[model samples]
Target: MSALDAATAFAEGLFEELRVNTTDAPGITRAAYGAGEEFAHARVRAAGRELDLDEATDAAGNLYLTLAGTTPQLPGWILGSHMDSVPHGGNYDGAAGVLAGLAVVHALRQEGRRPERNLTVMVIRAEESTWFPVSYLGSRAAFGGLPREALEARRADSGLTLREHMERLGLDPEAVARGKAFLDPARIHGFIEVHIEQGPVLERAGVPLGLVTGIAGSFRYRHGRCLGAYGHSGAVPRAYRQDAVLGFAHLVAALETSWDGLEREGLGATITFGEVATDPVQHAFSKVPGEVGFCLDVRSESEGVLERLHAELMAHADGIAQRRGVRFEFGARTGSTPAILDPALRGELAQAAGRAGLRAIEMPSGAGHDTATFAAQGVPASLIFVRNQHGSHNPLEAMRMEDFAAAVRLLLAFLAGRPA
Candidate 1:
């Protein structure tokens, strides 16, 4: 069988094996630092063992399956992605890239083909920030970029700290707290991630794959709250009432208006108040709400645009608070700066894709990935996107096997042609 065929079969098999971890729906629930994630990692480890690749886990639980080259001392290449998924997310989101890496090496091994430089297939941990509210934990830790405070942050459900989770997994939390770099920056030639494009651009453009131009960065307020005086809903006059809900409503509207204007003016940006609600204990049908809690996420490919958006958001909040006589309390905000893909690697990928007779679209990624973390650490990084449908982060994500095969072919070509 061709390498593309083998990789496709390998990915399908792995997907079926891991799909049983779902709960509440037909999607995966392999949350980061959870049992499901552990199971998936075990499967990857087993696969690496079958290929006779040397395997190890880093201080933060990132798994590396290595195939040494003739000159192992030189900086090597890494092909990898995360293994964790969001709650009720699809099977292919993160797993596809990981399996693609393994399949490439497996195909090479079977064919007695060896690369000139060492190649490491990485299965990173906790790339999905849904559970911990911190993005790319595994990759960041590998690059010594994870903040110390993130180590002690508690998980939303299990209430266990990230450090606790690491200890349970037999990884040294102390090393992570010390901000250890498991993979030396100087010893890494490049990082490449194959991922499903979570947007409709590729599918709409009628292409099987795409080359990522850049990854958008984001600022998030995970636990923001607005406060105002509580008063009787019926008795309080609209002019006199300090309605917190109204204040929050106005804030959302203002931010959205600005977002709309910015987009119309050709600046690409997005804002979402993904979570918002009034306090159940303090809220009543007969009473005006005194508090509003929400989560805010703002993303952009341009740092300048993001800075302006942040300023406008704060200004709108201030105006809403003043006009409504409400107070705003924003929780700890975290963000990563925008990252541009390496142009040279991108050119290589495009050439490889062309040689393999696959048409590819070029676009920017709205969602963040582990590739961004590697780029932030000064590594030349690239991301290849396989066209997918139904918008990602849910069970309905539909990626065709044909597209998967096309991506595998491109990946194999790229790996085979890399400079020694």
Candidate 2:
């Protein structure tokens, strides 16, 4: 078998293993700094050892496996992505990127070929903000960019502070809080990530891969609430009752107008209320809902669009409060800035794809990725999206092994005979 074949098989086996071990019924769960994530890190680390790669880790538990270059002085490549997944999310979301990196390195080693510069496969931690409300938790921590207050952020399921979680895993949260950096942007040649497309664009385009141009930024309210006074559903008159659900519904409807306005202007933005519900303990079917809990996520590649949407949101909320006799409490805002990818590197990858007779499109990412973290740090970076089925972040998310093989081939072609 060829080197690529062996690596592909390795990835296939690992994927199944991950799915089996991390099974959470409907899908899989790899909570940030949690048990499933721990197992994944350990498994990948074992693979790194088998490959004889140089191993290292940071205060934030980001793992680095390096295939050392012949020339120690040249700037090297860092290929990485996070390992954690959203609750009941599919197996491929973040894991594909890491496995692609490994496949590239494993293929090179199989042929006993050494690159001009070092090649590192990084296993980033906690990129899924679904577990802890902070975005890019592990990547930002690698650059000492994580805010101190983020350490206090509680995990959504476990209700433990990030500090406590880190401590349980025998990792150093103090150094993380102190802003200790493990990666130097200047010394890196470039960063690249291979991930499954979270949307249907590539599958619809009849293509196997896409080279991302930019990644969207987001403003998220994870613990938003609508508060009102409870009343008897049958007895309370419509004029006097304060319905929290109606207030929440009005806000949802009002945001569509802003989205439509942006669409009319040829601007792109998305407004989502991912979670919405009234308190289970304090509510009944016959009672008027006194309160509603929700989480709002607004994203766009343009900062201007984000601001405009935010402004419109506040205005709508104000009007809704007065008319519905309810108040909105949007707890602690967390977000990330949009990233413009390195086009020069993208052009080079495009050239490689062209050379290999593979069809790859250039597109903008609506979803966020750890690659954005690298781009924000002034590192030259690119994101490659492999075609996927049924979208992402859910149980039915799917990617073809053949399509994955195409991505690994693209990376192999790009890395082959490249300059230092």
Candidate 3:
């Protein structure tokens, strides 16, 4: 069978598998180490076996399927992406890359083509920030990026500690620390990930594919406090009240102002207050001390810029706390991961797209991804973005079938020495 024919068949099966395996709810609930994720892992292993690839699992729950090459001495090439999805995420985000990897393996097998280096496809878990406090859990573990105290941290929503949860999921937290899940630095020659654009840039520019220039790093901060008396709405005097809500509002405004300044400087910095909470109903007649907290997400393309912004935000947070008369505490949730892309690999991907007769554009990814983690590990990594509709993350999210086909074809051209 031709590579196109093989890819088509593989894609069809992959789409069906995703549709059938995922929940029917409006949003995806495949949280890290959840049952749905385990099912998906089983399916990936099955696909690998069908293609006569050897499958293995790491201590961090990352799955790897390897197809041996004719030159046994050569280091392997890796094609990877996470399989977990965000809540209410579309089918394409991480799923498309995984399916494309499967298709590549199948095409190579059909043609009896052995590469100079071994080829491995990886499906990493916990790319989404659902279960673990940090994102890219699997990739971080694979790269030995997890801190020693991280395993002891507890999820706020669930009483289970990180170690307890990992144990429940049949993973040894200590083993993971000992590099049991670590990748062989010398064995991986290059890495590639295919993902949906998750934004409208490519589609708006009328491009079928994007050669990702860099993946943005993220800096997350949680600021807020357990503050003074919430009193009766009507009875409390405006002068004598310690309002937690007012304090939170001040912090939020400061964050926005900081972001605005960064934007004016052309720093490409973004800040999002994703969560906020307060205790005790405002309507209650009794005076009760309430807690207020909010998350700040700052991202940028440069590490130095990110660090500078982080320091500025911290300073502003202190000022806000003092002015508001609230005892505020700031916690660093996740540190920055600077933008990194392999220049040579990016050029190769662009050349492949041109050979396949696909319109490709160079773009930067605003969101953090497993590709960033791999790049941090010194792997030559690149990303391919397929067109997405309106950059939506809802269940109704959709992508053009032809675009997916084009991406797969371009990938084939990159892998094999043939125009798609």
Candidate 4:
């Protein structure tokens, strides 16, 4: 097998290792900063050591494994993605990207061909907000952009603050609290992330890889609630009832209407309301529900679109509140800004793909990624999406080994300044 092929095989082995160890019945669970994440980190760290790479970590637990370049003084390149997975999520969502970085470096070693500039594989922490409700938790902390209050945010399952988790892992949460940045954007050459397309766009297009144009950003309300007055179901008349469920239904219908309008106007965004529930303790079949809780996720690539949606959200909520005699409260919102990727870097990768005879498509990513945090810091960044099946965030999510290999070869070609 070629060096790239061998490296690809090595990556497959690591994938199996991760799956076998982190299995949670229905799917894998690599909760942000949880045991599964810790296991994956340890596995990657061992791989770095085996490769004899220079290893370093930031105060917030972002791992960096470096293959030192010949010209050490030049600004270096970084290939990375988060290692955390959502609860009962597929194994490859985040792990594939990090492992791809390693495969590239391993290929370089096998061929004894190192780039002129340093290449670092970064394994980011806590990208899945299912654990802690914060966007780009690790990348933001690396750049000193994470809010100090985020440390106090509790993980959904563990019910422990992020600071406490860091403390348990022997990381310096106080340094992150003091806003110490490990990365200086101006000093880096570029950032590239090799991720599986979280959607089926590429699969539908019959392409192996995609050069991402931009990443969508979003505002999320994880603890949103609609409050109303409870009454006996039979006794509450339609006009006199203050039904929180009805108020929620109104908001959903109104936003969906606005969403349809945007689509007709050629605007792109997604509106999702999950975790909808009525308090089981206080709710009953024979009584009107006094309150309903939900999680709101709104995403868009355009800032204006996001602003417009936010305006529509408030307007609809106000109308619903007045009509249904209920109040809406969205507590402690968290979000990231949409990022337009560096086109020059993207063009380079396209050129590499062309010379390697690999078909690649240029597309926009609706899902958020760590690459956005790099782009937000003025660092030129590219997100390479490998084709996959069944989409992401589920056990059925799948990617062909050959497609992943195609992405690795493309990165290698980009580094070598020639076809792979």
Candidate 5:
């Protein structure tokens, strides 16, 4: 069979396995480092064995499957994407990349085609931060981006320290901290990732594939403890009473106004107040100390712009807090990741897309991914995005099967070293 034919068959089989492994009644709930994730790792290892690759697991639970080349001593090409999904997420977001990588490896092996350097397919453990306090745990460890204090950080829901959680999952946190069982920086020649667009860009443009330009860096702010005294709603004077809800609304409005100006500059900046909390009890006679907290997710394609916006937003928060007479504490829940993509690899992806009879456009990814962390570590990395159904990170999230197959074909062509 031709390499493309083999790739198609491999992708179909992998997709079937993914569906069986991930699907639940409400939708796919394979949250990062969850039970479903462990199942995925098992399946991925099996697939690697099928392709006659050597599979190894890192201390962070990231899986690496290597296909030796003619000159194993030289730096090799790497392909990576996370296997963990968001809560109730669609199947394609991360799974597609993994299956695509498997397909590429299978096709290359069938053709007896090997590059001058080795090829490594990496399946990172955690990409979604919804359950885990820290995101990109797997990729960060691989890239040596994890700080020493991270070992002590506790998971929000589980209240277990990262070290304890690693132990529970059969991984050694100390080895991970020491950067053991990770790819050597000098051994990775370049990296590529195939992922769903997670937005409507490609589908709206009627394109089949995207040659990713860069991934957007995020500046996340946790605005917690907006305090206000509660009194009888009917008896308290509106002018004198401090309303935490009103204070939060004011802050949200101010953030929107500021973001509108950024939007005008074509910076693709966004601000989302995704959470809010108030006192649970409702009492007319008792004085309630209302506390409100919300998240500010600011993203930009430019690192410099992201930093400037972060500073500006913090200043705005302080001004709003003082004006509203609310005690405000601003904490950075996550730091910004600068936009990065491998220019040479991106060009190669575009050429591959063209050769595969696929339409390709360069676009920026607004969401966070393991690829961003890898890029930060000086790895030449790029991403390929298939079309998504509406937005992602929801139960109803989906992507076209044909689009996925087309992306796989393009990726196979790229791996086969086909010229434009």
Candidate 6:
């Protein structure tokens, strides 16, 4: 069989095997540091052993499957992606990249070709950031980017600390906190990640793949609350009332209007109020709501745009609070910085796509990925996005097998060629 055919078959087979780890319902729930995630890791490990590749894990629980090279002294190439998924997520969110890397190794082995430098397939853990508030847990810990406070963070579901969860997974949290690393940056030439685009950009453009220019930074208000007096709905007049719900409602509308204005003025940015809640015990149809809470998330490719958007939100919020006679309590804002992909690596990928007779467009990722963490560490990193029809992080994510084959073809070509 040809390389493409073999890779396609491998991907199908792997997907079938991975299906056992999913829910009996419509989608998968392979959460990080959980049984489903462990099952996925076991599959990767078993497959690597079948291919006669060496396997290892870092202190941070990142799995590495290596194809040895001809030159041991020189830095090698790293191809990687995460293996965990969001709750009831689709089949190919993170699994597609790792499976693609495995297919590449399998084909190279069949062809009896050894790379000039070592090629490692890295399977990182907890890239979804859905279980814990911390993002890129495995990748950040591996590269010494995780902060000390993160170790104490609790998972949203089980409420277990990160350290406790690591211990449950048979990993040493102390070793990770000590900044242990299995992959050295000096010994690594570059990192390349293949992912299904979580948005409809490539599909809209009628392209098979995209060469990512950068990953957008995100800022969030996860615990914002509003306080006002509780009064009888019939007795309280609008002029004398301190309605927290009213203040929150107006704030939402004002912020969205400002966001649209910024977008119209060419300051590309996105704002979302993902959650809003009134005090459960105190809320009733006959009483004015005294307290309200919400979550606000803002994202942009440019930091300047984020700053401006944040300022606008605060200004609008202040005015709304004063007018409604309510107090605003916005919790601490948290976010990750934007990281631009390596230009030289991008050029190489574009050249490789051209040689393979494929058209790949340049785009920015609104969602975060493991590549951003690598790029932040000053490692040469690039991202290849396979065209996806539906959006990701849910069961409806759709990508054609032919498009995945296109991504694998480009990956093999880029990895096989000499470094630029």
lDDT of 6 by residue, 181-274 (tens): 7667788889999999999889999999999999998888888998999999999999999999998999889988988888788877778888
Which lDDT value does model 4 have at 20?
99
Question: Which candidate leads in lDDT?
Answer: 4
- Candidate 4, residue 94: the lDDT equals 83
**lDDT by residue (tens digit), candidate 5, 223-331:** 5667766766667776777777777777778777777877787667666767777756643335534567676677777887787776776676687667766666666
Better candidate number, 2 or 3, judged by lDDT: 2
What TM-score against the true fold does each predicted structure earn? 0.97, 0.98, 0.91, 0.98, 0.93, 0.96
Ranking of predictions according to lDDT:
4, 2, 1, 6, 5, 3
The lDDT per prediction is: 0.88, 0.93, 0.76, 0.94, 0.76, 0.87
Residue-level error in angstroms, candidate 4, position 351? 0.5
- After superposition, candidate 6 runs with Cα above 4 Å error: none
Question: Residue 113 CA error for candidate 1 (Å)?
Answer: 0.9
Worst 10 residues of 3 by lDDT: 280-289
Minimum summed lDDT over a 10-residue window in model 4 is located at 411-420
Q: Model 2 off-target regions past 4 Å? A: none
Candidate 2, position 303, lDDT: 91
Q: Candidate 5, residue 30: CA error in Å?
A: 2.0
- Which lDDT tens digits does candidate 2 get at residues 199-229? 9999998999999999999999988999999
Better of 2 and 6 by TM-score: 2
The better-scoring model by TM-score among 5 and 6 is 6
